[model samples]
Target: MAIWQHGGMPSSKNTQFAVAVHVLTYLAGQVERGPVSSDELSASTNVNPVHVRRVLGPLREAGLVCSRPGVHGGWELATPAEEITLARVWRLLQGADPVLGLHGPNPDCPVGRGVQRSLAAIDGAVAEAVAAELERSTVQDILAREVQGACSVPGQA
Candidate 1:
């Protein structure tokens, strides 16, 4: 198997970002319905509930989600889904870093120095493109489509 296929290129950080997006999109649909338990989300994602809560901690601080405590308590979106764009989600999860951080080039070669600079520029452009694409999507958009698909079958909840 290729190194990337074996978990080479996309780091844990990227995975966490993706998970956060999925969780947020899921919660957006449940906003009007009611709070969703982390266990339920974990079951849907096939991940541990602890991991889900760990990731959700940041979103909560960002004011994207609100949690309650009680027998029926769980989490709900803090804001309207349409008002929360994917760009906002990415920013909340990834912070202000470039999507790709730079690594120091070989100090022994002039070419390496130049390549590092060029790569940094490319990374900046890629980050901008990513942000632009994310900005075009909202949690509402993803949830509306996905929830409908999941609920399409009769007797399926």
Candidate 2:
């Protein structure tokens, strides 16, 4: 029932958060360039174009992105970057999926049952705390930070 582990539990590699962030950052950087194609975004993200479309589908439906059809078709942010918060995107992508996961434990084992119950009670508060933090920053803020890093050299910022 001790779900937290130091090494054995591997983190998710291709998380939706990472993909969304990458796509948003690319779009943010293209402010003067206009709409971007999924193939172009996928190339930059190193993910398949089909998979990029899958990730963008929810974003488009959520009003975070707008898509154009036909020959000149592509994707672009529906609202300004400053209006979109990381929390909003994360919540949309993970709808109904708990931010924290718990595994079923042996009901007959007293310790397992107790630990599971305790963690279940605490998970909501933990997820809420994470959301509060994410809500404080916008995609524009993240873009600015990324640009700052690019401008920095070695020990300077």
Candidate 3:
């Protein structure tokens, strides 16, 4: 499954990667609180609770988050927010899907065959670049920027 779409650039409104980051960032911000329910997470993401649960499945298996069952049961980070790099989340969600959303072209045409090979190479490079850049930041970095007013935007105050 594609973790990111929109020509390999993460479209927060459409991608699971974005939702995962949002969920993790919210969890990180609630570090002092108890486990957060899927309903609350879904509300925060403006997505269905089922979608929140689906996104949490991989995160849970990857040991990034853990869940509890019962009335007061909910989910919480299994790993520290500072240790969960965006790159790690990307890989876990990325799986074996093409980062650039490549598709099979007309193999009968020489141009199409050549373009496929070229794109495949470029796709690998782009994926690596994405991971490397994401490695520089963690969930905590995003949380800090959001909650602590650590605005990196120019003239945004």
Best by lDDT: 3
Best candidate according to TM-score: 3
Over 4 Å off in model 1, which ranges?
A: 1-13, 96-102, 147-157
Residue-by-residue lDDT tens digits, candidate 3, 10-98? 32334789999999998887766778888888877878989999988999998999999898788999899999999999988886566
In model 2, where do residues sit more than 4 Å from their true spots? 1-14, 109-114, 148-157
In candidate 3, what residue range of length 10 has the lowest lDDT sum? Answer: 148-157
Residue range 25-64, candidate 1, lDDT tens digits = 8777666678888888777666898999988898899898
lDDT of 2 by residue, 1-157 (tens): 5554423322244477889988887788676667778878877777898998999899999889998877768888888999998888877776655456676666668998899788877877777787888899888888887743342122321
Candidates' TM-scores? 0.76, 0.77, 0.79
In model 1, state the lDDT of residue 36. Answer: 80
Give model 2 RMSD, 1 decimal: 6.9
Off by over 4 Å in 3: 1-14, 148-157
Score each candidate by Cα lDDT.
0.76, 0.77, 0.82
Task: Rank by TM-score, highest first.
Answer: 3, 2, 1
lDDT of 1: 0.76
